[model samples]
Target: MTETPIHPWNTPQSTSSSASTGLTPEALEAWVNARLDLHHQALNRVLAETDSRTPGNTLRPYDDAIFELAASSSLIGLLNSVHPDKAVRDAAQAQAQKISQVVVELALNRPVYDALSAIDAAAADPATRHYLDRTLLQYRLAGVDKDEPTRARLKELQDKATLLALTFSRNVQEGGNTVTIDNPSELDGLPPDFLNAHQPAPDGKITLTTDFPDYLPVMTFARSHNLRRRMFLAYNTRAFPQNKQVLVDLLAIRKEIANLLGFSNWANLATADQMMESAANMQAFLDELDSASRDGAEKEYARLLSFSGQSQIDACSRGFWLEQFRRSAFDFDSQSVRPYFPYDRVQQGVLATAARLFQVEFHPAPDASTWHPDVAAFDVFDHGTHSGRFYLDMHPREGKDKWFSAHPLIPGIADHPSGTRIPEAALICNFPGGKPGDPGLMQHSDVVTFFHEFGHLMHALLGGRQRWAGISGIATEGDFVEVPSQMLEEFFRDPALLATFAHHYETGEPIPAELVHKMNRAAAFGRADGVRTQLYYTTCSLKTHTEDPAALDLDQLFHSLYTRFLPYQWIEGNRMYAAFTHLVGYSSNYYTYMYDKVIALDFFAQFSRSNLLDDPIAMKYRRTVLEPGGSLPGKDIVYHFLGRSQSTNAFANWMNEQFQPPSTI
Candidate 1:
């Protein structure tokens, strides 16, 4: 599902920009209030009118208006997470809940629901039909079908739930805890360059924030076990105990909502609108993947214990030991490969590959103002015709979100009064940034992340032009949304694509082909652990939503799952679920990560049959899987693209091969 962004962007040229730099906190606050009121007026006109064809009386116009709000609210949401100005960030946060509540209320509005329900979507265009269809489904899912009291209660729960979700995410973003390093010797065994860049504290004490750049280095390479433990505990436990209650309340509320919605549990209600259809099916799928992945995870953990000669493996020591084992066993070093992946060079490669794949062009928009100095905007074009634009915010800083993602805020549609609508998206990440002289370098894994997000961006760019705003761009089922991104990751894993841009930064030398081969060799080192970790979360997600919260012990449930699946022993006081922001939007849906991987690899299997850059195959993917967006069911899209349904054969084989012993026959 597309996450609603918390930040704003420059609106389309035909419309006024909702958010830009140099706006005061008061101005932002007033604008959000006024904008929401304006949105209500526009939507109220639609809701009040009985005829679907009258002015402001159709699904398309309603969609266009709500999406305008979505664009602005998401932009503010993004700014709340990453904007440097605390005042602006604070303002964004302050007004976010209000906007969220408004969105929920709008979905719950009876008049709007009745208006959409009265329309006969059967005779509408395919895209319009899709838009009306999904909107009606969303309305029912939003509890519009519930009787008055139940619906009112659901609204209350929704309001609270939205706040909780935002708070949980904010707690994580705020870094619930930070580890201070008073002794410089504790940083030993880490790269000298990283130390020099991160160490700036007085009294010779360096501070480590739980941000990925600071915390990951310490976890992966720090020699001191205590320091590593500290970092791990800090990272895992962030927003814990506090978010624990919030999560409990959130889960309990969802349970009630589900029961009211005529479902057995929250998971049922959540998946009713998704491709999974039922919790049982989701559990069965996860169970199958879990059973297959467990053996490899166990073997790898045992290997780690034996390799380090340690009695037990904890979360903190896992990364540090994994690095040591990878170096000795596979003869591959992650840091050593970094010199070839400076962010700037990698960015170019991604853009070039994207342009080539889509037969599109990108020109940097120098005069295009951004929310931040670090953000770069580009005008996208296809075959000399304007497509849309996108913004990239790639560097890490205090208060920035810790993960990578793409937000397609302003959707592309053609029915606007101002001619064809332009799709606009933002790509956000927290990779380490460079200083004045030196440039930032990313791990190959990070490059894969970039590719994955770019795939989503391209999906938004190419697919969002659906005639209706509601049915545009990457709007497919949550299970199928990651298909293209995952397929793109396979492109990165390809030796051919890696060689195209893996050139050394300083020496201007191509990466040794040996490095890429070793990467593939060690790819399974943490495969089981990673997969199992996600499974653990999925199980918890299912349990929390499927079962009665009053009868559940969340901490016990979390620890039990961790013990059952993970290599590391669960540490006390580390409430990982609190920081699991996916619980908000993707509750009972964490399995999509693994489930989508199978589909991704299956789709990539098609490319493997021909050249990686086969134009025919690429165009087929773009036209069928990319262009239709949610106009067709995900299954239909895949069938149209590949001439058949995707199967488990390719994914199962890939997993078995990855987990099999290197000397396997």
Candidate 2:
């Protein structure tokens, strides 16, 4: 039942190691350079083989190189996002660019592609065959067989693109802005814990940052319109004027690269390797979702305007009005549930729920070193078998990235000479309440987010026990990767499950069922609007990638898209695109959220709603959909789990649930 443990070695044979936890900037740089050297040595071994190519001689070395880069580069890249020291973060960024250059070279390497192409995978296992097929397809997509000059140009352009992306993300990560409130009375409607956290300075001035902990509460609860507007402007404009040009340059470069690769645009090129298949298909999917949710969104907006007795609501006021509407119409105040979800309790609940559903236990790894003292590490055990390790950096701090994401640090490899390489991952988030006295009272949505990100961590660890590192955990199509996260989000609504961990911080009383019902109903009221907003973002992502970037006006496109999908009046000077980090990662495929939502809702429908913890379908889903990793195609994963193609019926029903009587379960 025992799996391999991590070792503190400097060679490629080492299964696992800590991130740049205690390393100085120079040591971190040297560590990355050493890993790159090992990665190159592995690739050189693949090329030096003169005998007949086999999976052993060709694919194994290639995957080992991939494992080397994935194991080290991911952690190094993460430092730029979450590391506390600016000097280390900067060095990590430079090293990250260097790793990207190596990646670009490997993608365009001719001899390596030739060696892999020579492999006869007919006698190999299905996973190995699939791995080889996908690798060759990617090589072809990278134009590996193109002329030397073209490949050289592509390499240069890709390196530039990589640098631009890093610049864009760095701007967002370091671009947090602050707003000052002169009068304490203006903070009315904010929760008491938040007020305590932000007591006025001796000069009688209170300051707030655009970080989510401050931004979400202030936008959703603050009573002052001017304050909300100021916060909104500061938040949406983060990295603005700086990332603006960087995005333009990135798009232009992407378009050029796509043209060189024989695609219409970056959207088409990006989707070529994804589940959506094509940009036109992506548009069709978005159109179907829009048709399904537009009517519901219109009704919800009408009700909101009527409730507010206002002709039009600005962007900053949407959340505030929605909160007010929910309180008045559904008699549910989101704050009422806060005391039941203190950060520590919520963390315990999230871990316990995952353990029960997946049949795994989490043991705290207090001795594990992490980049920051705040990060908590845990070792996962399944039926007495050591599975993997994970870290949770779940609180906000100055100079940290302002986003919630699951980052895979090291890919698990089963055939290492020493033992199985235990996978490692981390969750970087900025939720509320991490201070000594401020019992991080989580919003209901924050709890849902916690569950959602854990879904990804589970996927990484469970699916990581694969033969090929290339198709390991979370290697599924980019569009399909969100299914697990989104599906787990639904579990947060179960009353029986909620009682297991959600309790009052002081009194320890489980949240009442009636209150849970009201919260779900109130939460449901905004479903359509949420969908519409997703569509707007998805379209913006698609349009910017598909259109001519030189002619595209980001501001005008944002305004037009906003009006087209939403009922709210556009706020001037709102530069959301400047901080749209997904543009750097997902490119035009932000529709992945909505697209995967359909599949996720369909998947969740298969579970026994009343007894989700013990449902056999949970394990079935883990095996068929999650453990397969990318060994099977995305469509096959869906079919294997659901016995058919995913349907939109569940999503449609979810959108209209607000109009129906609340579920009695």
The candidate scoring highest on TM-score is 2
Model 1 has how many clashing residue pairs?
12
The residue pairs found clashing in candidate 2 are: 433-440
Q: Could you give candidate 1's per-residue lDDT for residues 1-665 as a string of tens digits?
A: 23223233332321234245565676667567656765776786676665545222577558766766776677678778777788878888878888888888887888788877787666667666666777789898888977889878888988988888888888778855788888888889887678878675777778887877788788888999999888878888888768888888888888888888888898887777777888999989988888878787778888888999989978667789988998888898788888888888899999998888878899999877677777889999888888889999988766677788998867788566657878888899877554576678888788999999999999888997877666678788888888888889877766667778878989988887777878777775777677787788889878888878888897788888888888686666677787888887688788787888878888888874336765578888899888898777787887887788777777666665656666641
Candidate 1 TM-score, true structure as reference: 0.93
TM-score of each: 0.93, 0.97
Model 1: residues with Cα > 4 Å off, grouped in runs: 1-20, 48-57, 659-665
Give the per-residue lDDT of model 2 (tens digit) for 619-663. 999899878887878999999999999999999988899887555
C-alpha lDDT of all candidate models, in order: 0.79, 0.89
The Cα error of candidate 1 at residue 505, in Å, is 1.0
